[model samples]
Target chain A: MLNIGGLNQGVVIDHIKAGGAMKIYEYLNLEKQDCSVAIIKNAKSSKMGKKDIIKIEGPITVDLDMLGVLDPDLTLDIIEDGKITAKRNPRLPAQVTGIIRCKNPRCITSTEQELPHRFRLTNKEKGLYRCIYCEQAYKR
Target chain B: MKHVISPLDLSMEELDKVLSLAESILQDPEKYSECCHGKKLATLFYEPSTRTRLSFEAAMLNLGGSVLGFSSADSSSAAKGESVADTIRVVSSYADICAMRHPKEGAPYVASIHSGIPVINAGDGGHNHPTQTLTDLFTIKTLKGRLDHLTIGFCGDLKFGRTVHSLINAMVRYPGSRFILISPDELRIPTYLREEVLEAGNIPYQESKVLEDVMPKLDILYMTRVQKERFFNEEDYIRLKDSFILDAAKMQCAGKDMLVLHPLPRVNEIATEVDDDPRAVYFRQAQLGVYVRMALIMTLLGISAG
Candidate 1:
């Protein structure tokens, strides 16, 4: 068993479903940023069938709201000086500016490449967003 | 007020106001010229309903407004990962008003929340097509001389026919109007509609499998496409499709003054031979789309469409 050394400062996104770790990485844009990140896939977990954990060493800005979109069940633990300090289940944003594509095949956003496909937060209580052009809703 | 998101949101007075304005525009086309001059109407169609989109653009142009926007999400930044709220916020800044057609159930309702300008829903998935309802209302009022006390038969794909649903919703408001629903057993009107709308309204209605049998009793026959897609079996489609097609032979059984209505893009649902009939009102119905939308735009903008 390989043990991850205590991080001086960073976040550990744990209990992510094993296969869904890549999605989490893409959601956080982890590959593009300057940080030491380790993605451990197929780790043993009593609570989850097969869990994947993301260890980000050094402070890296992560949009937790988007992370919520990828995996709402993810739990984030911010580590500082090798001790768990802050824990958060970041609420998904009610309105996301640019994330999901409008599924309407005939929406203006479908034809005009220059135009932005917009959606509004409809039921924030349920983390729902609807397309501005087509009226499609997404629950995060 | 910048959009026609749903029919129920429009009060009877508001609906009548638009209809009356449409009548004025029809009476004097030139009087309404430049109603949207130097402005633009953006049609953001996320689905393929060329007929509806063209009607909207034509309405805007006839009122002296230019048109912009795309017909699908695939051709826009939406494919590149933009959101609907951002799209409308940006489009609203550019266009005076927008007509949107989407494949989702409540897309326009979502758009209207963040949109600065009016956002009319051309069609939203299988949910609603309110503008078509307005057009139907306008046509019935114009041709039949009244929307009240008429026997309107909604024939064919009532299950998925947004137009039929919307028209039925609009007509149920008036007194003395009854519905004769004609469709195959497989494609009957949905139960929620029957329960929540028809039965709740306590409107008199009859259901039958034959069109000709009910023809003589109808003041208006609204025909909808019998979608081949709705059937799971080829045999069932072949069995029920011909039952709904409105043919010249069927017209002989109809009243002399009875109007035949269709939300256009007809696919042999009404035989071409029947188009020559004076009572065939589908083309007239299609033309009314412009007038009704003209009225709708001006009403939403608080301008006199006339």
Candidate 2:
């Protein structure tokens, strides 16, 4: 059994798809933060069979919606006074701005550095986001 | 108010309006001559397209609008490595509307984002050609007198033919529009189109390798060239190059009133002998390209069809 201390006042990101925590970690730039952060990779989970979790030791604003874009299975727990005060499961956003880059080489966003990489949720059932300018579908 | 970057951009209602305007223009060309008189159209073509460029120029001139911009990237600032965004930014200032054709898939879309004026995608690699789709819609509505309840046959190069894909995307919106997609096995329509566009919409469609077998049932026979340039493998190109040729013998099986249309500049895919056939309207289809473009340009410029 792996033992870790509870966060006094911070966020605990849970239920990440196995092996997806590092990407989310890199995306959030959590490594550069001044507070203590621990990443539990390949943690045993009854629901997911295997999952990853991240515990941040101090209160810091994170764009949870971006985590949803990266991995919709992720759940966030806001800890206060050593208690899980708020639990949140981020839904796929309707519109995401300047997060995931359009992968299509021909997409205008590739050449135009000044343009924001904007995508709109086109197919909710399939979790598809299409680039606003190029209309290239990105499946999550 | 709208930039036509793809066929999907136009709603069914908007498509009908453009088609009707095209018909009215076709009937009395003199009435709509001065509709775009004071307007300027910028044709920013990054690739060499004789027919599309000339047709656009003719359409603007016929509507009494002047055209500006280069015929090729070599002649334009694009040769100097100017991005599509910068080119459009500069051109939009001088022109009321711009029509751009590029080798890249979403070049016009990028231009549309940056330009102050409306941007029309003339052709974008294998991705889209909304104006060509508009021309096809106009041709179908004029010849068939209806947009619905028609069995349209798409023959040859279904996989890479952007015109075929665009036309199918537009026509499937109309009620009772069935598609008979005929192509060689190697050149069959892409699975995305089959599953997403046809199957997802619940639009009835049938695929076959033999064009003759499907000819009698078709109200419209749209032939496309098997573009050698699109194929990376020379052997595959040679094998499928003459797969679905539209000769007079093939036309014998087609309906007398069945309209045969092609986005022109044909090679050997369509035999020259078939050109004399009354059903052969590919030339007229090319001519309708002008009217459709005129309608599109006027509509994009907010000029009422008076």
Q: Best-fitting candidate, measured by DockQ?
A: 2
Model 2, B73-146: lDDT tens digits are 89999888788889888997899998899987778888887899999999987778998999888888888899
Per-model TM-score versus the true fold: 0.70, 0.89
Question: Per-prediction DockQ scores?
Answer: 0.09, 0.46
Q: Name the TM-score of candidate 1.
A: 0.70
* Candidate 1 residue spans exceeding 4 A from truth: A1-140
Error of 2 at B25 (Å): 1.5
Tens digit of per-residue lDDT, candidate 2, span A51-89: 999988885766676778777778989899999899988
The alpha-carbon deviation from the true structure for residue B263 of candidate 2, after best TM-score superposition, in angstroms, is 1.9
Every model: Cα RMSD to truth: 8.1, 2.7
Tens digit per residue, CA lDDT, model 1, B175-203: 99899999998889987679768997898
lDDT of 2: 0.87
